[model samples]
Target chain A: MTSGITRRVRVLLWAARAGAADHSAVFTWKTWLFGWFVRMLAQVLFFATAGNLLGPGQARYLLVGNAVLMVALHGLFATASTTWELENGTLPLLVASPSSPSLVLTGRSLFWLPDGVACGLGAFLLLGPVVHLPIGLSAVALVTCLLVLVGLTTYALGLFLGSLVLTATDLRNVVSNAALVVMMALSGVEVPASAVGPVLGRIGAALPLTHGLLAIRRVLDGRGGGQVALLAAQEALVGACWLAAAVAVLTLRARRSRRDGAALFLT
Target chain B: MSLLAAAGRFQGQLVLTHRDYLIDLVRTPLLAAVFLLLVRHSGQPQLIAYGLVAPVLMAVWSMAMLISGEVVDSDRQLGTLELVIAAPVDFARLVVSRVWVTTTISLLTVVEVFAVSVLGFGITPEVDHPVVLVLGLLATAAATAGAAGLMAALFVATRTARTFQNTLSYPFLLLGGVFVPLDRLPAWTHPLGRLIYLSWSADLLRAALAPAPVAGAAWRICVILGLGLLAALVGRLVLGRVVRMVRETGTVGLR
Candidate 1:
């Protein structure tokens, strides 16, 4: 049992490293930096311009919201990389392996944590001069924690969605695109939750990014540390629940696939 | 069938059979709805109009761009690019036909957004000059197709064509003034924006939708059409050169 656990851990670590390398291999360091910087800047400018038209004192709101959203977006893309396995016809092997499929999925997403944090921090820092928000080091640190939680939650949610690709492989683009737009609309990414109507506001409350954004806003506005900590705790709890849900869903799906021999015929 | 007719029919068939292509049709309106949701709280009729129109323009541009942007690469991926190239047909005309069909399909997004804006949100944008608005949409479609052809020519031989295609979207949206007026951008970018046909198209669109007519409508329309012609000429030259290069190097389906 001890060796089995060790072997699983070793496999998980190997998969995480391989995933990270594959993700990074899509672009050179220079290309990645330039592409992401330009993309994030464009996104920030687009929303900030819209905020300008909306009303006064709203640019900052949009800047922070979109910056944090970059993290969740990264998480979504990271989890969606699982589709590559299906495309390459390796998904069934992963499912049929002695190691747990849930663990493998989690490992596949581990690298996104750092990638999300970097995007969040990079967006904040890059847009800081443009938007001119009053962010200090301590506040930055606090937002970093908030972004980490958001990343975990979004990654878990992405994993759940990615696992659904096992049955509907062609849904990869539709699901990711729809989820990004839906999350952006509902999670106060570019709009305040209160203004998004009661129904959407309730939905937003269930999303992990909403609480994290709320907490980051408070910290940026110089709120007390106690409230920030409470919000962070809530965000973490939401993320934990999503991770647990993803595990349950993946387990159930794996069992179904095995029982029906669907794993053998996955295209 | 003629190459143009065949290409158009092929593209239409692809759109019909490919679930992904059908899903692509829905992305724009969903994004438009998201934009609408973001600005719904503003309660300002003008802001609502701007939000609604921006997404429609983006949908038009994206669809036109993707038709050419993905055409060659997709053919290559499916191992049919060499066959298409080997056919004794005007390749540039084939590309143009494909883009034209895509542009026509993309126009549905404008109607979809209009319906959503009016029926879903109770915001009916005013079009003071319906004729000018229609003309503007036509010009925008032609210019976007030209630009897509130009990009398709440039991307056909490149390994990172898809990446470049995706990266061009936001920058074009910014420079095209899809979401904001040209004057709102940095002063230096104004000239750059004016160079893009989408900027002119957006100006014409905003003017048509505004309660009063804005000046320079005629000139903007002329410039947009002229740019479309220029892009078409340049794209034809580039596509011819790239095809020759690919034939010489025998890299039609490579990568």
Candidate 2:
């Protein structure tokens, strides 16, 4: 009998394979270049506008905020793309494979790490024209850690939403879209949460974006990675909650589908 | 030759289409409510702050149209394209009618936003220039219709247009002066904003309603309307040719 570690590795390998398959259709180098070109152009344009509008230091802060925001968007929305697959009747096949659903989703999201990191660096590079911030390896480490937490939480949310497709009638896409748009608006990425009112401020304070942004803000202001501990803890707690929720919902949906003989909808 | 008969036919179609659009728009009040709450939360809870909601709401409207376009695409894929094309009506007229219906629905959605602002946020439109306001709204409606049509055509052509639509639509949301002032855009994006119908429409509305009178608000409205009409024409031409080709060739098994 294989040990648990070996078995887990096998599952991870299979999950990676599944993730690779999802993008096989659109994974051309041209597509990657197109995506990068568009994103980089937009980022440059955004930075130029911000630099002209704000003081140099403030522009640097805004860029840091946008960097953290890019991580949040790439991580969270990448997971949601998996939910779209599930809702479209392609997720069941992946889940039925040797790989677990969570592993599969993780692998799929991790595939975007290269793109996210590249674009983030591109955005950070533009920051030099705006301000002279003390960005070092420690700031990088903090952003990376915060990104991990964001990815984990977002993956869990995606799984929970995907599981609902088993019995949902029509509102899945609407719910997903609404959730994403609301998250983007409330994340305090573009605008300060404090400017938005008490209710929105409270909501923003509870979000991972707020914590990650605060961490980056401090780092850009000369504080090192030490400030990330509080944010990491909150993100860990939120990730745990969402992960547990995803497991419960996925199991319930899978069990129901099996009982109803509707497992065909999974793939 | 009777005017009543012609008017009856067109009016009947218009009313029915408007009713369908209304039903769809009203089905999701929660999102609209969230937008209202977002504006209130943005710490700019004055009646003039209603302008802040324009960008996001317009984006939402675009998404709604995209979703509906996907539905239409699915129908086309299922061999229903020919049925619509074969109907005893001009293709351009049909497309325009559908867009008109959708634009009316978006207008109603804005009305709902205003109502929510008045009730929930305690804001009121100054209504200094009623003519400008009405014209501005109509211009905005026209612009939205054009954008929707363009997206519909794009989606109809490519199966994977959703992601492109999603990523590309935000420019209008951000650069169109809906949430922020247009002057805030960097020099580069400022000119591009002119290319976007939303920017022109938003500028017209803002000029009409904001405390100060904007120079050439009427001209901006005309330019926006012209762009909108041009977009609508292009959309019709592209979608019609594609649909006709699909019908003749049965390409990709679509009717």
Candidate 3:
């Protein structure tokens, strides 16, 4: 059992490296930077311009919200990696592998943590001077922590959704796009969640980014560190729950697929 | 079957087989809900109208560009590009037909957005100039299809068609003034915005829908129609050249 655990760990790391390399191979440096930096700048500018029309304070709020939301977008897009396996006709091979499917799915999304962190950091650094975000050393440290938490939470959610791809291959874009729209709507990314209906507000509370966003706003407002720490812990707990749920769901589905001989078919 | 019938059948197949097209159909309502919920506190009829119309225009633009951009790649992927190219048909017509079908399907968003504005927000968009509004919608649809044709031409020759297709989404949204006025953008971007037909379309739309008569409505409409014609012409020329080049190189389905 110990050896088996070690082998799974090795497979997880190996799959992570392969996933990262596959992602990197899709773009040249120019395209990557253009997709990441330029596109992000455009999104920020668009929201900032729109926010300006709403109110004076809205631009700052939207700038920060969208910057943080970029981390979630990275995580959301990472969930589509399983669609690549389906497209390449390798999903069956993956299902047939002796390694645990849950671990493999977890590993496949492991790179999204660093990718989301980089995107979050890039959005912050690039937009800070332009949007005049309060970026002192303490704010930076707090935001960094927030970014890490947001990354882990979103990546865990991505792994959860990625496992669903095993059952429905065509759900990749629908899941990603719908998640983005819903998250942006409910998570106070564009507007305060409180302004939304009570039902959506409660839904936002359960989401990972909501507390992290509230904490980021507090940090910017020069609130005490205890609040930020509490929110960060809440966000981490949410992420851990999502990761555990994903593993459980994937294990159940994989076992059923193996028994029913449905693992090889696209259905 | 006639070319138009064939295209219709193809679109029907897409609707049945591909969930993306179905998602595209509902995108405007989803976006409308998001935008309306965000600005529900404002309770301004004009703001709600702007929010409603913006997503309708975005839906049109996205559907047009996606259908146009993916046609060549989809054909290649399905191993039918060479057969299609070898057939005695005008490739540009085929592409234009597909884009028109997409544009028609996307027009459903216009109704959905309007309904959201009325039912959800209790705001009815004022269309003071009904004639001008109708004319503007037609011009916008034509211009969008034309732009998609041009993008389709560009996608046919590029190896990284999907990346390029994805990259066009935000730039067009930002520059076209779908959600914000072009004047709000930087001075340098105004000229670039003017170059896109959607900017002119948006101008015409706002002028038609505003409570008071806005100036330059005629000029904007004219410019949009002219740009649509120019784009379709350029797309035809470019697509012809690219197809010929592909034929010469025998690389129709290579990408």
Candidate 2 interface RMSD (Å): 6.7
Residues B140-201, candidate 2, lDDT per residue (tens digit)? 77766776676677677766564465446445556765544577765787887777777776
Clash pairs, model 2 backbone? A92-A266, A92-A267, A93-A267
**Stretches > 4 Å off in candidate 2:** A35-63, A78-80, A84-121, A126-138, A165-170, A184-187, A190-206, A259-267, B1-53, B64-72, B154-163, B188-190, B243-255
**Model 1: how large is the Cα RMSD against the reference?**
2.1
Q: Write the per-residue lDDT of candidate 2 for residues A48-115, one digit (tens) a residue.
A: 34433433343554566565555555544444455555555766675466545555554554554455
Clash number for every model?
0, 3, 0
Task: Please give the range of 10 consecutive residues that has the lowest summed lDDT in model 2 chain B.
Answer: B18-27
Whole-model alpha-carbon lDDT for candidate 3: 0.78
- DockQ, per model, reads 0.60, 0.18, 0.58
lDDT of 3 by residue, B188-223 (tens): 999989888888777677778877876777787889
TM-score-best of 2 and 3: 3
Candidate lDDT (C-alpha), each: 0.77, 0.57, 0.78
For each candidate, give its TM-score against the true structure.
0.94, 0.78, 0.94
